[model samples]
Target: MESLRAPPTAAGGLFPPLPCALEALPLLGVDFSSAPSRQKPVVLAWGRRAGAVVKLEAIERFNALPTLAERLSAPGPWLGGFDLPFGLPRSLLQAWGWPLDWAEAMSRYARTSRPELQAAFAAFCAARPVGQKFAHRVCDGPAGASPSMKWVNPPVAWMMHAGVPLLRTAGVTLVGHAAGDPARLALEAYPGLLARAVLGRRSYKSDEKAKQTPERLIARKDLVDALEQGRQPWGLRLRLSHAQREDLVEDARGDTLDAVLCLLQAAWGAGQPRGGWPGDADALEGWILGAGTVPAP
Candidate 1:
């Protein structure tokens, strides 16, 4: 077995610089979501090793757009397993008449304001029957997302609208999209899919400080053990130490857990073709802009 202390190196040199060495370690899982305040939204990149899923790194919060730009700009061959919605529901798109392609739809969506988009979506939904109004994107079904365009669902649509462009601009290759550069790859990942599979309905993390209790710690430990042993149906595993486990458990919001989940998604993507996603054909779509479905008002 390889020693955990050994640094991860790539074909050219050590990966991700020494400071971000852990991130370079292969089989990194990530969980990303926007932590938005009244001022600006922060993109939180959470990571964990594939084998030792329990151990998590600190939340790498990027507050400014420039910082995110710099990180995305950094030399890569590094795959990012982002938690944002990669596709919109098919139903929503047809109703709204947005561009069907991923890149084109995003460009059109970006031009509109939040309120305008919300109003437009609302009007569309209001006319439809209550239960069937909100449409899910292809990714949302397996990933189980709240309607892709829902504002309360942490503005994931906005995240896709705002963030995907940056990845494209950064020259990263979206795994299922047209490859602008062979070196950098972006893949759609959902940590919840993995988490639910292993520990259904059991809460693994909490943002509220009060939820970080002894019981949750034990649950996290169990979750970590399962991943390390590749006990899940997904064949995922984690590698970590006692101290690392304690550290990850201490932060209950599951930041570390989420990061590891993202890492796993990235690893899954690495095995697929440049223009394809890792899962079944029905679950994935080619890199089309505005890929998610729009909800009716």
Candidate 2:
């Protein structure tokens, strides 16, 4: 392993060589979402090595099923920390009389498409009183997400439906599922888990020009400070250049922040003692919240 204290070199104004230490980390954190289309939707995913706070990487965004299948089949010992929900809301499952296990719920949901899911959920809501129609899972309440089953406001259920099966087909091991390969781990992680711990509602990145004032720069500086001092819950450190800092601060849409979140997940994976890569079920699940059920394959 390389020294973590070394500073990185700024290159060509826009690129920086990440500290060599990041190479040793193996964790892969993914932020996934689907864009609507007249045909099939597009899936976008990105993340970084677990223990290293630099060197972000993106999984190729796919508009076609064959392209996605190719990426999923590529070789690597990856512990993917996807942003999708692993479990459906207990309330929604109960109301629909669906299975409660994460895998089963996703499997059941996978049988339906986007329009089908929306229509089914809408029908369920139509029979209930206006405000009480949508159902939420335990995490949804705390995460402040719309109903876990909702097609909008994050549409996490569709995320799982569309995403999980790919992992399954690719033969990756899901952390909590018995059917998953023990070597290729997949876990659920929320970027907010680390962001809130460090910034505490302080806006660190944005897209709006008006909000990109000096005050936000100071917040970015504060976030940089926290990351440098290892104040984040994951005990990770970030290395950034002055130009990089300015760019991250000026961008308002939070793309830079999302990238940093991916950086932390990479850092966390790199920190693992099982030679950086998660080597077994215990190590993989160690990073996951055991409260949620692991659905059967």
Candidate 3:
């Protein structure tokens, strides 16, 4: 996970500067997709607190977004940190003459196809000077994330498009977007935020099997060690069995690790009041859970 400092671990499991609080809600971290498949399924890391430590219960994967949505909509309570942009950059939406309100913007966007979205974004960039093509949202700078509208490289723009609407379909309240259900709350999360905090620009995983190496494997092990020892500046300890540790290390795609990062973030949020959300959050521009300040230019 990517992250920044300026916060410390507190009793009750709050991660300061982010308003995170601790609790034992059914915690989850999701790595999502618009077109989910077995090859690259939607991954979820599920866990709950066991006395002083968090015990990861399971790692679940689904190849279809609709199926996952059905499961998320099931009754009772759960909270999750999803790795996708909850809102678009306000400036980018305005330039495209799209709706500025979060609901409207998302509704309009969900109707569009990936190909069309990419073409439009490319055309806009083509007309602009180099390096000034993309407009950013409030969280991008502080979160150190790519512009939400970029369609290539990481293709986060498409991710936002495919992912956020699922919360609505599942009737899971998006904390910043709608009146959230305490029973089923969904918040934005980026595993990179926390991973960066721990590793500091150290490369960890690769999709191409050929790129997976012993060095990267060692890096992953080191990361797990830091997490297990309660070394987070934020101060939450990850308690895993020897088998669990091996499972996390064995998965080279980093999907399980990313979900675990999101899991920790959710664990922190569960500990906070109102999920450690700041009062200044806007309905139009969703804020990241751990970010202290708004994203900059």
Candidate 4:
């Protein structure tokens, strides 16, 4: 049976309309990779702000993390949501006697080998109780994200180890990292949060080509429609030709859609206080763009 959940229109009334169209900004959403491949390259969903709508500009690809850094560091102004952890769990760092300062901790973390990092994380989990095997960042709960220390089943930790270093060297300011340039705010983005809000748990895209069935396609179209209509979850509308929409929805990998979602989230956060993140966000646990109060169960 196909995995699916609530459709996009299931809760369209839950959220208020987003703010009026944001000032034009170069928006980006990245689906990163620790070890990029030609077959499955890192994808950037690029967008540009038009008068009252954000337009899908392109689906950019990167086969290496270093090259991505170079592009980001080039002389330009851009704001983006990266689908990677910006910081490790404070609890884990404290428990392991690592530096409490976000910058210092990441400085050390960027130097560790994947094998060593995996073994250390494994040992940490081994010493904990079953229910508490993984240490979590404060942002994890509200963002509906997995523990950043995880090494398998998505391996976001490795994504962090590989990606954050590039951002640090990119000459661009990270919204949750430190203040440098307002025009180059790089924030951690979780497309899953927005997806869940709109579709409740619908399975829209699959990485495996064989699993890209008609149901997933319909789900994608529904999601795009909701975004176009400026519905809840976010009030940002996206504009693209029917061909672009078809291209975005046809990719079984969903990388393009993930990027697009991140781009919209970036636009939504642009006019908020500190780009929709709180003042305390500075490295230890950066927040996702649209994560506010979680709904009560």
Candidate 1 deviates by what RMSD?
Answer: 8.8
Provide the overall lDDT of each model, using Cα atoms, as 2-decimal numbers: 0.55, 0.53, 0.74, 0.74
lDDT of 2 by residue, 118-197 (tens): 88788888988977887655544433334456677567667777777777787775544424444345655555556656
What TM-scores do the predictions have?
A: 0.74, 0.64, 0.87, 0.87
TM-score of 2: 0.64
Quantify how close model 3 is to the true structure by its C-alpha RMSD in Å: 6.2
Which parts of model 4 have CA positions greater than 4 angstroms off? 1-22, 50-52, 179-182, 280-282, 293-297
**Error of model 4, residue 279, in angstroms:** 3.8
In angstroms, the error of model 4 at 276 is 1.2
Q: Residues 22-117, candidate 3: write the lDDT tens digits.
A: 343588889876677887788999888544477788989998888898889887377789988888877778789988778888998899888898
Candidate 1 at 163: error in angstroms? 1.7
lDDT for model 1, on a 0 to 1 scale? 0.55
Off by over 4 Å in 1: 1-30, 35-59, 210-215, 273-297
Question: Worst ten-residue run, lDDT, model 3?
Answer: 10-19
